[model samples]
Target: MSVPALEARGLVKQFGALLATDDVSFTIQAGARQALIGPNGAGKTTLINLLTGVVEPTEGQVLLQDHNVTALSSSQRVRLGLSRTFQINQLFPHLTPAESLGLAISERNGSGADFWRVAGTRPAIVAEIEELLTRFGLEGEMDQPTRKLPYGKQRLLEIALALATRPRVLLLDEPAAGVPEEERQDILAALSALPADVAILLIEHDMDLVFTFATRISVLVAGRLLTEGEPEEIAADERVRAVYLGEDAG
Candidate 1:
């Protein structure tokens, strides 16, 4: 059998006396889509940081394709085909969506700072950017300055930028946050359209979207892995109900 695309073994993170991640272990198989869900302050963000090397782990290891990447830097991880989008939109405010995404692809190719050469001047790069824009449903908004685009569009732009990296594994942190209900379906549609070869690990609050896209779901609470299973199994879990979903009902 093939090794998982990504795996965490006994991962732990600490700041002073508080344990931000408590011995979490999980695996994301190649081509699988998994969701990470938890209540507020459950250390979801901290776990993401640990996986991407933004924060060093106090214990355990992170493996990419069964190779230890625990000590790699963030940029190094990106180069290794691991990319992520933030919970908040991160973009070049003054640049149009096309320009921003083009720059991201350029950076991934290691030429992002070639300011004298306009990204549009490169035919191959331009074509790639346009393709990604269309794929992400941003073709119509491509030329608009990122700041002028609506919140949902900006969120899409962020995902587009991350996709520019051609990641083998994508980590999405709250892709649906702040998106109004009316626009959320579009986001979900775009995500569902992503290539099946790209393994995606999503951190999202919307149970509906989570259940719709995720093949498996992992629940975290107070920095620990509460449980992980199929969506129906997680939904029916008594411990998950008492700790997380019960609050959603209230």
Candidate 2:
């Protein structure tokens, strides 16, 4: 079998007396469209942090393409083809989308200080930036300062910026959060069209988005791997229905 794009092995995260993640284990195969869903404060954030190396795990390991990355910092992981977008937009308000993409792409090439210079020296990079902007529906917003764009556009920019890193695995945390109803479909379309080679793990609360985008689903409840399966299986699970689907368990 091909190696998984990302894997978690018996992960556990504890804070004082609270067990945030409890012995969870799972894998995201290359080219997979996976969703991680759960209730509020269900340790989803903690698990994402552990996977991305934002926090050290109290126990267990994270492997990227079967290589141990449990000891690496988040930035180090990003350098190794791991990238993530936030639940809230993380963007530079002053930079245009094109400039932001240039900066991220330049940073990927170790030219973090010279985004414009990189674009000047490399037409290929400029083309790439333009293409990504178009793909994420930000082409029209490209030249405008990020802060001036609508919230949905800002969310798209954040995802575009993550893609700018050329990641093999992408973690998306609530990509549609705070987006207006009218713009939500655009976000859904953009997400549905992501590069197939880049495995994605979506951490989201939007059931419509989750069911629409995921081929596989992993349910996290109180920091544990309650279950993982195809979307249909997950939707039909009695336990999942009880805890998540708002259906009567009986």
TM-score for each of the candidates: 0.95, 0.95
Expressed as tens digits, the lDDT of each residue in 82-193 for candidate 1 is 8999998878999998888877788888787787875678888989998998888888888887889999999888888888998989999999999999999889998999
Model 1 off-target regions past 4 Å? Answer: 113-116
Candidate 2: tens digits of C-alpha lDDT, residues 57-168:
9999999999999999999999999999999788999989999998888879887776355363688788889899889988898899899998989999989999999999
Q: Which residue pairs collide in model 1, if any? A: none
Best by lDDT: 1
Candidate 2, residue 193: how far the Cα is off, in Å: 1.0
The best candidate in terms of TM-score: 1
Off by over 4 Å in 2: 113-120, 247-250
